[model samples]
Target chain A: MSLREACECISDGDVLAIGGLTIHRKPMSMLHELIRLGRRGLSLLVFGGGPDVDLLIASGMVGSLDAAYVGFEILGFAPNFRSAVERGEIKFTEHTEYSIMAGLQANLLNAEFIPSRLLLGTDVLKSLGYKTFKSPLTGEALVAYPRITPDVALLHVQRCDEYGNAKVDGVLAIDLLLAKSSRRVILTSEKIVSAGEVAGSPFEVNLPSTFVDMVVESPLGAHPTSCYPYYTYDLWHMISYLEYCRRGMVNDYLRKYVAGVESFESYLDLVGEDALSRIMI
Target chain B: MAPWTTDELMIVCMAREVENGDIMAQGLTTPMAIIAYYLAKATHAPEASIMQLAGNIMVYFDEPPQASILYNEYRAMEHAVHIFGQNEVYETIFKRADSIVEFFRPGQIDKFGNTNNSTVKAGRTVRLPGGFGIPDASPLYKKTLIYCPRHERRVFVERVDHVGGLGLNLGGATSGGREIRIISELGVFRVDGRSGGMRLMSLHPGVDVEDVLSNTGFELSIPENIPETPPPTSVDLRLIREKIDPLNIRRLEFLSGDDRLEALQKILDEELRIWRSSNVNRPKAQQML
Candidate 1:
């Protein structure tokens, strides 16, 4: 199916949690389609930072962020997130990656709250306006992070069968949990394999087809970011993007990459063969 | 002998801070700490376990990970047993682990050892990355070491624009012997265990007292006799350069230029290809196990 068809799975103002840890397997193809379609007033749910979050803010897609962190990790400050925060353009529901995971766990378990010691000595509780529940047995204070259910989950996997059984190679970070916890899941894959092929190595099949709603083939989908076993992250591209970010060229960048290109295919053409091949060694 | 860069000194100093039987955690964008964690493991603290670059808990590698925590050499993960999911890993780091220490890098740091990845400019207006996982799991670590490559007034401030962490707690201190230390190219700064204020613990060689004072954003504690940070021994340098990180990829964390990064990217690609071919996930002879 087309990128547009896959993106139709999400609606504007929906709380969308995108996958990947910093510069890992994010669904760039789907995100590009969302940008082209001009989706607005979104609330983002994510654990770590990367170009995806910056892209959302640069295009004015995000109104509020239920975020743990949102930088390019080692690469540096996310330009749009930084600029928006500096200018007071966005609202943030503060979290650490732990809280985000705990919150997601609550949603998965259908629980009211999850107790934790994550916010012990920090202002995350007061500012975020959450509370802690004492253990009945021990009377020990425990922070209770509220449950969160993203309206949709967007994730990129190494492989997915026709029916949407995703094969996650290497570290199965939070992609498995994110898919299970969300109301709807849209997976963009590097290769679309037959369910038989996936079934052959059933142990590696992380998320059963029952969990996935849409499966779109997106070769080299996790560009700029890494998809383990395929290629390392294009560090040059990240640095170049971060340079644009540092100089506050969010619009110029969006104009060139996200908005300027009509689709992910056209965007890939602009990315050039040189950049991708370099990361492939 | 080739002269060592400030990063080399910082890595060595950071390595010495490690103790045996310690489980240390470092985040992304923290190559120096990652190397130091392994350097400790390779040297005196052999019992030390590092959180591998890809967030694998209690994993060890014979060589430097081609990158950092995210892309640890999976082949070297022969010791890889007992996978910890993201939640379990942080839970282990925070609540369960004993003798835990974590290394972190914040965009901005303050007098109380409080670091901020939140924002800048003092009004909650300027946003840096949200606090990652620092606030929740930080209090659990027995010691926290901060790494800031650049040291100046803006880097070190009187008050962080936002408190991403409650470093030493100027008042209402906790009972745990929570220690916080910082290592930069210029000097080593340690928290006054009692006052929770920062003190100039040691100056790197050739760095003057005036230079350290001038660069700090707030007043720093200058003792009557401040020592110099000890340099890495010749044997230690050999272990770091040859055995631990042969590619010198560690320098890319700070000193990487376009030519170097381009080269590093290519190396990483090849590394991944190799890891894929010999991946443990695939069906194989299975006798290696």
Candidate 2:
């Protein structure tokens, strides 16, 4: 299936999850396309936060966010998410920084919930409506975070074939687990090589085509973004978005990037080659 | 122009050293040094070397300046130099500087140079503007200079509520030898070469030794006769009022509650305005020159 068709499958109020943290090989083009298509009311579930989340939230398409550590580094704080929360515009399920990954790990393992030691003597867990369970032996109370299984998992990869056999060079476990756990998986790739290229090296395939429901040929897809080994990140944009979010300008951001674009082509045009050059692997 | 404020005086003292190619780092009260460093380059120290936490030699402009001058490059320039953490620069470069400048409120500092920008004694917790790589960088620098306005016992305590960065221990271990200075509105001080505690080097005019001793929690080592810190010179006052004061950067004091948020927003707005206006017409260079 085409990437757009896979994105089109997403209906309003669906739970969406994307892979990667803060510009390291995120499926950014696919995210931009998803926003350009005007998919709204999304409950975004992710372990860590970055520009992709910022863009989605700023577009006003994200109804709720559940994550940890969402901000641009030195540039500033996460203004969009902060503004949305401040204005009571979006519902949020804030979690301790560790629980986010643990929840995803729990889902990948098919556990009902994951136990965490984070938020002890802190109000974060209780305030987020998570329940605490006491250990049967030690009597130490542990916070249980429910497993998060998104309706769709969008991922960007370094290499893949039309058949959807994907290969990621580094950090395969998280993306692989996310693809396996999600209801549907979408793969955006830097290059669509022949299946024969990776036929002999099956272990190199991060996510086999069988797991990928859709595959999009998006060279430099992580443009104006980072995919480590491939290119350095566009730190300026990340910092700017973070500053904007810190200032509570999520709506303004959405108007400019997501909801503002008339079409996918326009969005692509706005991104320009500068962003594209960064991911030109 | 507005009259020269003491904050500018503090900047002039620090800037003179930075202008001489001395590596400098500062803790939370870095605004004065930040403006001073930049202004010094424009006016006096054109050839001075400056870098940020990431080892990149760029200046950054944020609501609260993050690390060294390099972070400012992100705000001043249009293109981004994609890096991981914001404090990465300070962690790498500022930690190993030849000199550092730290500023604190009266009640926040302890004797060992641990600065508590967070909470006072009570259950009341005041979250600081996040740690800016000081914990790692403090101990490694060759020299550390602390700045404060009010000289009271609460300010010059024997120990701080929290150590923002490492203190005299860093100075003691300096392979090339380190110097630590404490500059305030009232006077200047240096750690006693023998005792490792702060000793009165000089006092500002109108400031008496009793006032200094009374406010300090620890006993101050006094020389026979301490000289007075020179009054702000005409050039110093001119630079402070005309060049730095016009920006009114000091109003960005990090307070708690809504005021903190508002001050942050204003700083951000000001930085963004400066960034946008400066680069609006500048053509993108083929390479970083």
Candidate 3:
């Protein structure tokens, strides 16, 4: 399916999970397409996020966020996420990384909640209303992490087959879980290979075809953030992006890189061949 | 012997925390901890398995990759022995909770050893980049060693505005039996399992109890004879400077203000230069996979 078709599957006010760890392998190009299509009111479910979450929030697309972390690693706080939460513009619920994982695990297991030994004696637990239970056998303390099932999950991968078996080259940080747990899975791959090719190496397929609802062949789909083994994250581009966000010019950024561009190819042209080459591994 | 800076001392102290056969884990934006893990892996703790990003996506590496902001998941691919997903890694860490040694750097910490990385609130102000894995996993590790580059009053607080991770006694069974240590530029402080407050374990050379007392926001329990923190051996210094971290990536945490940015830029430029000069072929788009 086309990127547009994939975006069509994502409706407004849906619980969307953006896959990848912080600052790596985000489905940015598909997001750009969604922005171009003027998507709105998304409730983001993320474990570790970076520019993808910030950009969505900055673009006024995010209505609420349930996240573990949402900041640029060393560059500092995510400008839009911070402001939105601070001003109460967006509904924000914080979960530690493990809790988010536990939530997903609960969802996967068809359980109401999973018992976790984390978040005890912390303000996060205090603010979240002190939900705890004692283990029946061991009588140990545990926090009840409820299921967090997303309506749709968007992911970027190094490669995928026409049949939708995807290969993620680097860390599979929650991408597989997002694919399995979400009600719908959309993947944007750098290349679309033959099913035979995927069959040649079944062990490498991170997401099976049964789980993927849609697959779009979008090369350099994780630009700005990295699609490992292909390119590193564009640091200079991110710095400029941070500058734009810090200066309260998110609309300008969206217009220039996302809305203003005719297509993802044009976006690439703007990013330029040399800059892309420099980041390519 | 060349004189060692505070950052180097902190790195050495941090490396010492890693037991010989322990499995140590660290999360994002931790060059100091990363370097220490590498140093430990290369030196005293040869059998220690260093899991980057806690167990997110990357695994044990034989050599330290060049520390570039660009070199995260990308470089992890160069040598990762086994590339497991986050779920597998988390389960492994949990299963080995009784033996794993994890390192953390909280934004703010209190005398009770309660740490906060989620936010630092001042009046209505709240910080972002919420605790990634700190609150969730730190309490479960057998040894949770925290490294704070700056030992200022602001960092060592009376009480963290939020308890991103539980303190010595507050964690109950999960965190109670675990050993917690704070390695700072001044010295090493340990959470006294009995008192539930921080006590001076050792002082870095040239730093006295007065300096630590003045810098800390709360009172500390001091021993009768506080030993000086052991300085880095010549071999350790050589490994850090000449081999593992020639780019001086470990200094990022120690620097502040404009200096940190400038230092980062320098490191980036050098990493780019080295990459450009290297004989490896850049993978074309189609061949990347």
* lDDT for each candidate structure: 0.74, 0.58, 0.82
True contacts kept of 3: 0.77
Task: Output DockQ, candidate 3.
Answer: 0.66
The TM-score of the first chain in every model comes to 0.95, 0.84, 0.96
Query: Which lDDT tens digits does candidate 3 get at residues B140-185?
Result: 7767789899899989999898888777766543544666789999
Ranking by lDDT: 3, 1, 2
lDDT of 1 by residue, B155-179 (tens): 8998887777668773221337777
Q: B132 in model 1: Cα distance from truth in Å?
A: 0.4
lDDT-better candidate, 1 vs 2 = 1
- Model 1 bad stretches (over 4 Å): A132-142, A243-256, A260-262, B54-58, B63-83, B122-125, B170-175, B192-196, B222-224, B242-289
lDDT of each residue in A150-191, candidate 1, tens digit only? 889999988789999977754555777798899999999988
Q: Could you give the CAPRI-style class of model 1?
A: acceptable
Off by over 4 Å in 3: A138-141, B57-65, B281-289
Candidate with more favorable, higher lDDT: 1 or 3: 3
DockQ winner: 3
Which one is best on lDDT? 3
TM-scores, in order shown?
Answer: 0.86, 0.51, 0.96
